[model samples]
Each structure stands twice: as structure tokens, then as C-alpha cells.
Target chain A: MSESDRQGGEPEPEPERTSTGEYVLGGLGGLLVLLLLGFLIYQAAVVRDTGPELSVTVTGVETAGNGWSVHYRIANTGGQTAVQVQVTGVLSRDGTEVEESSATVDYVPPGSRRSGALLFSEDPGSGDLQVRPSGYSLP
Target chain B: MSATTDTEHLATGVGRAVGGALLFALPLFMTMEVWRLGHTVERYRLALLVLATVVLVIGLAHYFGAGPGGVSRAGYLADAGVALVVALLTASVVLVVLAVIDPVQDRQSALSVVVIEILPAAIGASYARSQLGAGSRRPQAPRYGHEVFLMAAGAVVFAANIAPTEEVVLLAAKLGERNAAVLVVLSLVLMHGFVYWVGFGGQEEATGFLRSFRNLTVVGYVAAFAVSAFLLWTFGRFDGVGLPVVVGQTVVLALPASVGAAAARLIL
Candidate 1:
């Protein structure tokens, strides 16, 4: 395919030629395109569109700076993506709400997980801790 | 020796296609916004996007493809088919290596991610096959309509490279009306400069300033804006935004896209 292989000062049309390798690669490529497109079509036909379903679980609590940080993992299990997800953590001491901390996750894609932390002056370990998704906007 | 050489030529063409896929699509593969978009984008939309990509790739291959069997109707078709395969396979491998998808567990997600990536990768493959391969063939001059389409394709590449990130939306939110208007003028000036003054290979014909600006640069920016809006919508960037934000984001993305459009004229 190099330019030097062709002769003369003017550009002569190269004779048509094909090798076994070209046929093999080309055939394989064609087959793959058909299969991939078919699969996507199948998915589009069968899957139902759904909105984002979000859930938050507290993973751990640690001392961060002057406060205790409540680390949480947020997951979206539905079809859509959740943007600006708000996760709120409440630490209650003896049935009284002592501290409320919340964090905002940028986005949580369906079937994916994102982690964030909330800080509170009172240690979550000293009280009954409850973490839940407050709200989220759709993308 | 001739047979071996032909086989080597095919191999080199395939190799360049692979390299081109990476060259164009690596940014999107690494972007977190795109990875999220894979699962979030509607299934039918993703499927439709695949079909659109197929059509665009075939058109591009007609101009840039080496056509291993010869530059005939069947030759470019074969080239387009191979470019699609190379693009898909290359995207799959790279996304997997980057842990962008877990094929076994995130099966639905993996499919969507690959589908989204296919367009840019396929275009890159076709471009590489035609332009970078040994004994590259010079394509015939593109018609006016084809020129606009090339600009749109270039816009897609540049816009896709950046649209998935949060910065577009954030930048739009902050750009305000005055800055956005300034951005529009800046994009036009930059596009015009690249096409006429930069002296890039295959520069636009130096028609009189007003005529060239009116015909090519202005039209190209409009095409870039439309392409940008489509891209942002595909990534769900327009889903929950106000009208002003939508317009602002479109203008922001049109900046890179207009540059790409101008570059396509010079390169493609």
C-alpha cells in the first residue's frame, strides 16, 4: 500500500486486489455489526422505561476534623439517572433528634453506586442513627 | 510476495482504524458523565443512536475509505462494515479495561455504554482508514450539503468529547446572558479564523470576506449549535433545565463544536 510501490510520475489507478485476510476481517466485521444492532433492537423492544429509584445506606462513621462524619453509599436501581440527590442522616438521642446532617450527591446512575459523607458535631455512635434519601431531581 | 503485501495492507488498515478509535473516543470513555449516561439514556434513544451512527459511518466511509477490494460501491460498504466492527470491539476493550462497565453484572449498563461510544469510535475508524492508511487516497471534492454534514460530524466528535461532563451545565448556569452572547460571537470569529486565516491544509476557498463568512462560518455555527443541543439532550443534559439554561449550554458547547466544524473543512 506504500506510495513508492506504484510507478510513474502520474498517479496510476492501482489494480483491484483482495487478500484472504481482508475477506476474513470484513466478514467478521459485518457479522458483528448485525449482531450488535440486533441486540440493541431487542432491548429497545422489551425493556420498559422507568424513573430513577434511589436508596441510601450508611456505610460507616468516622472522626473527621472537628466533627464526626457519617459515610453513606447511595444507589440507583431504577432505569433513569438521579441528579442532585439529597441524603439526610438523623442522629437521635433518647427519642430526641440531636443532630441532622445531609449531603448532596451529584448524580447516581441506575445500577450504580456513589458515596458521600455528612458531618455532625455529635457522634452518631452516641445515638440512634437513621439515614435515608431525602429527595433527588431527575436528569 | 504480492499476496503477502496485500494482506499486510489490510492488516495495516485495520490497525489504523483501531488507533483512530482510541484517538477520538478515549476522552468519552474516561468521562464519568458518559458512564452514568449509559444506563440513564432511554433504551430506544440509544438504539436509534446506533442506527444513526451506522448511517453516518457509511456516508463517511464513501469518501475516506480505502476500499480494500477497490473503491467501488461494494468496497466502501465493506470498509464501513469493518470500521463499525473495529469501533465496537475497540470501545468494548477500552471501556472494560477502564472498568467503566462490568459486563457480567452491569449487563444492561454495559450494552448502553458501548452503544453510546460506538458513534465517535466508528467515525474515528473511518477517518483513520481513509486518511492515515498507507497510500491514502485523495477524496473527491465535497458538495455544499456534504460540507455541512462533515461539519456536523466534526461538531459531534468535539461536542461529545466534552458534553458528558458537568462543566457544560455548570458553565452555562454561570455564563449569564451577556457572556453567552459574547461566546457566540467568539465562536464565530474563531471558526472563521481557522477556516481562512490559519492556513491549514485544505482551507476553505478564499471567497470575499462577507460571502465566505455568510456562507460557511455562519452556517457551520448554526449546524454546530443544533448538533450540540442534540448531544446534550442525548446525555440528558437538557432534561430538567430551564429554557435559558438550555440555550446557554447549547451556546457553550457550540464553541468547541464550531472549532471542530472549521477543522473538518480543513482536514476532512
Candidate 2:
């Protein structure tokens, strides 16, 4: 066979070589991406510091003919403002239901306390009262 | 190309598209299924049901549809099933940790909040990353991740509208007329974020942010939101259906579409 016919095709050009700087830059870019990912994770996990605890005190319990009045004292023990404070509780006597009520105080400033009363009709022979609070996290 | 080549190409493209769609839809469907399961059964049972349903759907899809011409079908199904299971497992872990540490005594709302709000967001993030090739060494992953982040950020901001408060008093004080309008606009932006992320993530291979954002998935969400709004206005519970419910429904619809897109992209 003729030499030209025997040869399949011309040789292809060689692939370009990457520079050391290019490789290093690529590696650095990957590292930066990884660092960004770590930062995102940290941001997601970090919880902002919430200020202050609100102290709730049951001031007094007074009995009347048909019902009893329970008094509350809500004090902000935190350095932040507390808004729309609602105290809820059930009054039980001798392990039986006496009454349930809630009181709402609009806003309580830092280092301040507010008092309110709620009345329940069923007489509690005499039992300790407990109060509970629920609302969005205080600002 | 030859007829056979053309047919093969068409099939491959369809397979890729479908796979992407399934990937995008799977997470959203799983989220809804979880929410439903939570309402009906115990947490353990809900987890079991989700797993079983996922396995069954994938197995059946593969068995029924995967054939000589359906290689992509089986692969996409598997991808979607795995994506959902991973997302759910991650969510469960997060929920368990939250419960152990914080112990939300009011389990109902707490569970609902996590399943509905937080889990979806996380899944959205992961889906975005996966699309962008963050989970793989593929060049497209970072781009996908960026797009996903943008979409999720948008959705999150939009969803912030419904933060529970004591009453309208708080709403009145905080959300003045101008503020409310701004919030509504922000919510729209958020919805767009989710749509763009999911839509782009669902392609056979992840595309650039602009391309993905303009895809059918994002368009579908925006369209659905608009249609739902129109529907509510015409025949919803108040004189007009409330915006909150409308937004919620829009999000719900968007979830499945996004998952389907992601699956399609991954599998195809």
C-alpha cells in the first residue's frame, strides 16, 4: 500500500498543560467554598442571646360567698421589654377543680412588675394555685 | 441524526425532564405526606408510613414503568425516593434534637411548625445545593446552590408574614398599612425564591440562575398563586379569601413541583 494510504490520519494536537498557579487557585477556590459552607452552618445553628426572665408571683387568694379572687404580680426580671403578658392558671382545691382564669397586662417595662386579679366561682376547700404564661419570646 | 438516533435523543430528553420533575416533586410530596401523617398518627407511625409509602411508590414506579426504553424512569424514581427519605430523616433528627433540648410542651403547634415551616426550608436548601452540585463534584452544583439559596431566602421572607401573636393588636401595632404592603411584597419575593430554586433544580442538569428562575416550575408556582388568589377572591371564605390561607396554599402547591423538578434533574 502507498505510505499516504497506509497512514490513518494526521496526529492530533497535544492538550494544553495547566499552570501551577491555576491548580493552586482552583484548590483555593474549593477551600473558600468549603469555608463558606461552614459559615452558613454556623449561622444556622447560632441562636441569638435572648434577654431576661419574667418572674410571676401569686400575691394573694381571697374567698367570697360564691367565688374566690386570685391576685398576680408579674415582674420582668430581664433587661428587655415584655409585651402583651398573659398569665393563665387553674385554681384547684383538695385535688378538685375550683376555677380557671387568665389576666392580660399590655406591656411591662424592664425591672418592673404588674398585678391583676381573676375570679373563680367553685370554692376550693384550700389548695395551692399555680400560674402559667404563654406568648411569643419577649423582646 | 438518523431516525433511531432522533428517537433515542427524544426519549432521553423526556426521561431527563421527567426525572427532574420527580426529584423536584418528591420532597414537597413527602412534606405534605408528613404533615398529614402527623395529624393522623403518632410520630413513630408517621415516620414508618412515610418510609413505606416512599418505598412503595418508587418500587411500583420502577416495576411498572422501567423497561427497555425507560432506563431514565427507574433511575429518576430511585433518585426521588432517596432524596425524600434523606430529607425526612434529616428533619426527624432535627425535630428529635429540638424536642430533647427545648421540649416544646405544646406538641401540636410545635410539631406543625417544624414540619411545615422549618423542615421544608431545610429541604429546599438541600435540594438547591444538590441541584447546584454542592453534593457532587459536578461543576453545576455551586451554581445550583446559589439559585436554591436565593429561592429559599425569598420563600422564608414571605412566610414570615404569619408569625403567631397574641392578637390583631400586635398586627395592628407592627404591621401598619405601609408595612403590611411591604410584607406582602416581601412574601411574593420569597415565593419566587422557592419557585426558582425548585424549578432550576429539577432540570436534567442544573442550569444558571436566570435560566432556572425562568423555567416552567417557577412560572407554574407564580401562575398557581395568581389563580388561587383569583379563585379565593371569587368564592373564598370571607367576602374574599384571606391572603394568609392563599399564601399557605400557594406554598403547598409549589412544594411538589419543586421536588419533581429536582428529581428530574438528578435522574436525567
Candidate 3:
């Protein structure tokens, strides 16, 4: 309807500003933020690729679903992220394996610990329960 | 210029840069690969990745304001440098907050991880104009150079989304040579069709298939391939891999990059 449209004109409704003043100020602020952030990062950390050199100790045992629940705590001694850490427990009486049970901890960071319970189908009152790390992947 | 306007504008650009840095690189920081990449990857490779990012940020400064230098090479480079610093700052802060870079336990590796994450984050910051800045750089008639830049920008944005993860490598490993080749063909067709459907500003009219093919399609594919190679190298997808593996990964990643490239011409 307007002359600009009829003539196929390029109409810029908002004036484009390419000012330098604001960028200078922003750049200074950004620099300060960077310095502060750098300082913080220099003092921060994350889980490293520490694997299954974990300490699995049986703290107690409780009776649960049709079996026994072996309570244990796993601590990562190695400096790596242990992903999908699975612990296997074998209940044996007189050197004969009775029931096998496994517990999984989604992730255990280096120098960190996770507590879980492994369920067994049979009672291990008369047997010695041996719990160890089955396997783990690096996170 | 009034003092008030100057301060306001300065805050605007800085805020956008920092916000853009944090927002755009969120996905990358969340990825486990990015967090530990610095520890496993070689030093020279990381340097190359940073260098490539610097080059991209230079061009990106045109749309995202780094200075008052309009269209000047130096200005773009300065803006890019600013983008890099902002991105680094943003990444450092977030890494610290998240405890991904544990300074007390492994300070060196944590710093390295932040540096690695900064690469993608800075690139994301360089794209603040498109992502956050509302009408900062008004679109004009697309030039050949501008079109190429847009394609590259799009490619970077798309490829960055997928490159840092192990999935790209896994998918590439699964794809056979024949399948990869077929996928490349499909990618080309999609790129060509995309441009036709969403015409880039100031695109020329070409009636014949050959003419259109030569103009937009070929150019887009070339840009896609170039972007793909750059992304693959940045993500360290090429180390200890043979030629087949490299090509397979590059092409697989290039599909989305090409589509992104085509979209860039039309969107910005």
C-alpha cells in the first residue's frame, strides 16, 4: 500500500546500532568475571577416571524378600569414576556356592562411597558370604 | 553520546555475551566427554581446536557485537577474542558450580576440563546475535561471503550438538562404507531440497536443475563437508582412526550440518 512496498524497498523499522562504548564496558565486566571464574575453577574439581579399586565391606545383614539383604558400603580407593559399579556376593557353605546376589551403584566418584543392599534368594546364616566387585566401567 | 545510553548499551552487549555463553554451551558442558576430553586428548589437538574456534569467532563477531568496527577484519577478531574470554569465564563459573572440575582433588585435570569445555562454549557465545541478541545485527541482502559464513555458522551449531558425544563415533562405526556413501547422497538431496523450500535471502533464480544444482546445492555440500571436517577435528574424532572411519564420521555428522547450513541462509 505504501510507496516503499510498491517500489519494493528495503524498510528497516528498527535502527541498527553498532556502538563501541557499550562493548568496551561489557568487555571490562566480562574480564573481571573471567578473573573471578578462573579463581574459582582453580579451586574446584570433578570425579576422575578411578576404577574398581573399591573397598566393599559388609556392615550388616537383614532379612527381606524371600531371602537376605546383605548391607555393604563401597568406597572408591582408585582415582577414577566407577560407572555402573556392580558388586557380587557369593554365599557358600563348606566351599559350595549356595546363592549368588548382585547389587549395583549407578556411579561412584573417586574417593567417594556408596552403600547398597544385595538380595539373595536363600538364607546364609550357616554360610560365609563373600562380596566383591563384579565389574565397572569408566564414566 | 549520552553517558546513560553508553552504559546501557555496554551492559546489553556484555550481558548478552555472558548469557549466550552460558545458555548455548549448556548441552556441551553436560556431556561427559567434554568434561574429561582435556585429560585424554593430546595437547596439540586441543590447540588446533582452539585455533579453529578463534577463526570462526572472528566471523561470528559480525553479527554479535564485539566493537564499533563494522565489517572490519580487526573488529571481528577483537569481538571473537571477547567471545572466547566470555565463554571461558562462563564455562569456568559453571564448572566450579557443578563441581565437575574438582580443584581440591585434581586441580590440573579440572582446569584442563574447563579449558576443553570452553572451546564449544566460546563458539556458542560467538553466536550470541542469533541466539540471544534481539535485532542487534539486522539482516541485509546476502552476499557470497555472507552466505558462506551463514552456512558455516549453521554447520557449527548443528555439528556441535552431536560431535562431543561418543554416539557419533558409535553410529559411524556401525555404518558400512556403502551405507555411508548412500547417506551422503541422501544428505545432498536433503540439503538441496532445503534451500529450495527455504530460500536464502537474495538467492538467484535458476529454472534448470543443473543451474540450481551448481549454484546452491554444490556450494552447500562443500560448506557442509568443510564444517564437518572442522567439527570432527575439534571433537577429537579422528585420533587413532583410519581414513574410512574419519570419512564415515564426517559424512554422518555432515548431514545435520548441511541441513543447518541450508537453514542459516534462510534464517539469518
Number of the top-ranking candidate, with TM-score as the measure: 1
Give the TM-score of candidate 3 (chain A): 0.63
DockQ for all models? 0.31, 0.02, 0.11
Candidate 3 local lDDT, B1-268, one digit each (tens): 5778756755665577777777767887788887656444444455555556666676666754334433455445546666777777788788889877766655545655766676557766666633433334533444667677768877877777778778889989999989998998998888777767545563445568887777767787888888788767866788779999999899889888888887766555
Ordered list by TM-score, greatest first: 1, 3, 2
In model 1, the runs with Cα more than 4 Å from the true position are: A1-9, A15-20, A50-139, B1-3, B67-70, B132-135
Residue B223 lDDT, candidate 3, scale 0-100: 85
Backbone clashes in candidate 2 total: 33
Tell how far residue B150 is off in model 2, in angstroms. Answer: 13
Docking class of 3: incorrect
- Alpha carbon deviation, residue B151, candidate 1 (Å): 1.5
Best by lDDT: 1
Tens-place lDDT per residue, model 2, B160-208, is 2221112222343445456555554554454445434455443333257
The local lDDT score (0 to 100) that residue B7 gets in candidate 2 is: 54
TM-scores of the candidates are: 0.76, 0.29, 0.65
Please provide, for model 3 over A1-139, each residue's C-alpha lDDT reduced to its tens digit, 9 standing for 90 to 100: 2456634765443433445653463365345434544443443334343344877999998899687888989877775557788899999998998889998887665556778998887786778899998888864
